[model samples]
Target: MPLLAADNLSLERGGRQLFRDLSFKVFPGQLVQIEGANGAGKTSLIRILAGLSRYGYEGRVSRSGAMLYLGHHSAVKALLTPRENLAWHVSGEADFSDRDIEHALARVGLYGYEDVPSHALSAGQHRRVNLARLYLSQSPLWILDEPYTAIDVTGVGELETLFAQHARAGGAVLLTSHQAMAVDYPVSRLDLTAGIAS
Candidate 1:
């Protein structure tokens, strides 16, 4: 069964129609990328699918299991440390032990900075803190928006490997990224510009 499905989605912003009658399904073990130009409503579409913007559009979104959504913003609190952010995530994830949180931070290259204030970290480091959630998440579906924004080349490669691993493990990932993936796994594309999934 599909992890998530969108039916007849349509959106209009600022008197401009971004998309109309858009629909797609994200199934288990699939890595899907939402593709579009800057003003093509990629983020809008992702937000709709993730159930973050429920009232503004016309569509029905259904999910089969728990999901993890990482939006374009880092969403890290400036006063909190990396460890604290993961320990008390806004997504309401289950309580994880200190060891697991630190390990996840380490995987995303925030090992020693786990206790450092988020205000002192660079943009990329803040992004890493958000990426750490991917490692700790047990959700079957991951919906990420612009996940590669501040990551380094090596970090990007690591994320690709992680995505591939997730798909191989019967999990699904739906993300919006301008950088083309260079992984060994097959990536399905949902081009918002063309209103088609391929």
Candidate 2:
């Protein structure tokens, strides 16, 4: 079976239809990019992919347990330390020790900023803190919407390296971005507007 599949999917927001009858599939080692102009339902589509919009769409999504979803805004809490912020949202079912958290922090370029409240950090540092969770998530499917919003060039390169590593490990990613990316790895893109025009 494909790692994840969406068939005849539809999503609406504010009582307006965002997208309809969309079908797609993602398999192991594949990175699926959803490209569209702003307000073309990218966020809504990801919400359904993440299972956060259960009743807002009519479709079938087949996926296994290892799915992680990140939205446009960094979910990291401003009042908490980076370590504490991750601890709150990541699963209690999974056990990640202090070492794991520390390593994750370091990997995302937040090495010395781990203990500081996120509000004290710069925008890029805050984004790195948000991305640190990916190191420990261990999910096979990563669905990110505008994941590049707040990071610096170094952090973006780090993220691309990490994404390449994940795909090498048979993981899958579905993401949206406004900035053009040159991925050195294999990637397939689904142009939503093209589908609509056709």
Candidate 3:
């Protein structure tokens, strides 16, 4: 069964129609990438699919299971440490233990900076702290918007590997990234420009 599906989605902003009659499905074990040029409504569509934007859009989005969504912003609090951020995530997806949070932070290359204030971290580091949620998430579906924005080359490679691993483990991922993905796994493309999913 598909983990998520969008039906007959249409959106208009500033008197411009971004897309119309757009539909797609993301099944388990599949990695889907949203492809489009700037101002093509990629982020807008992601927000719709992630249920972050409920108004001003004509669409029906359905999800069969839990999902983890990481948007364009890192969504980290500068006053909080990396450890605290994960422990008290605004999403309230799960109650993570100290060990679990620590392990996830280490996986994202924030091992020793776990307790450092986020304000002291670099932009990439802040993104790493947000990306750490991927390691800790048990959700079957992951929806990400521009996840590679502030990541380094090595970190990008790691994320690609992680996405592949998730697909192989019967999970699904839908993400938008300007950078081309370099991975062994097959990646399905949903080109908003053409309104095609293949």
- Alpha carbon lDDT at 136, candidate 3: 83
Please identify which of the two predictions, 2 or 3, would achieve the higher TM-score against the true structure.
Answer: 3
lDDT of 3: 0.91
Give the TM-scores of the predictions, in the order they appear. Answer: 0.96, 0.90, 0.96
Better of 1 and 2 by lDDT: 1
- Which stretches in model 1 have alpha-carbon errors above 4 Å? none
Model 3: per-residue Cα lDDT over 1-198, one tens digit each: 899999999999999999999988899999999998999999999999998885599879999999899989998999999999888773487767798999999998999999999999999999999999999888999999999988888989999999999999999999998777898999999888888988
Q: How high a TM-score does candidate 3 get?
A: 0.96
Give lDDT tens digits, candidate 2, residues 1-198. 577888899777788777888988888898878888888888878888888864557888878767888888888788999889877767553888888888989998778877998889887777777788788877889999888887877777878878888989999888988776667897788877675421
lDDT scores for all predictions? 0.92, 0.81, 0.91
Against the true structure, candidate 1 reaches a TM-score of 0.96
RMSD to truth, every model: 1.3, 2.3, 1.4
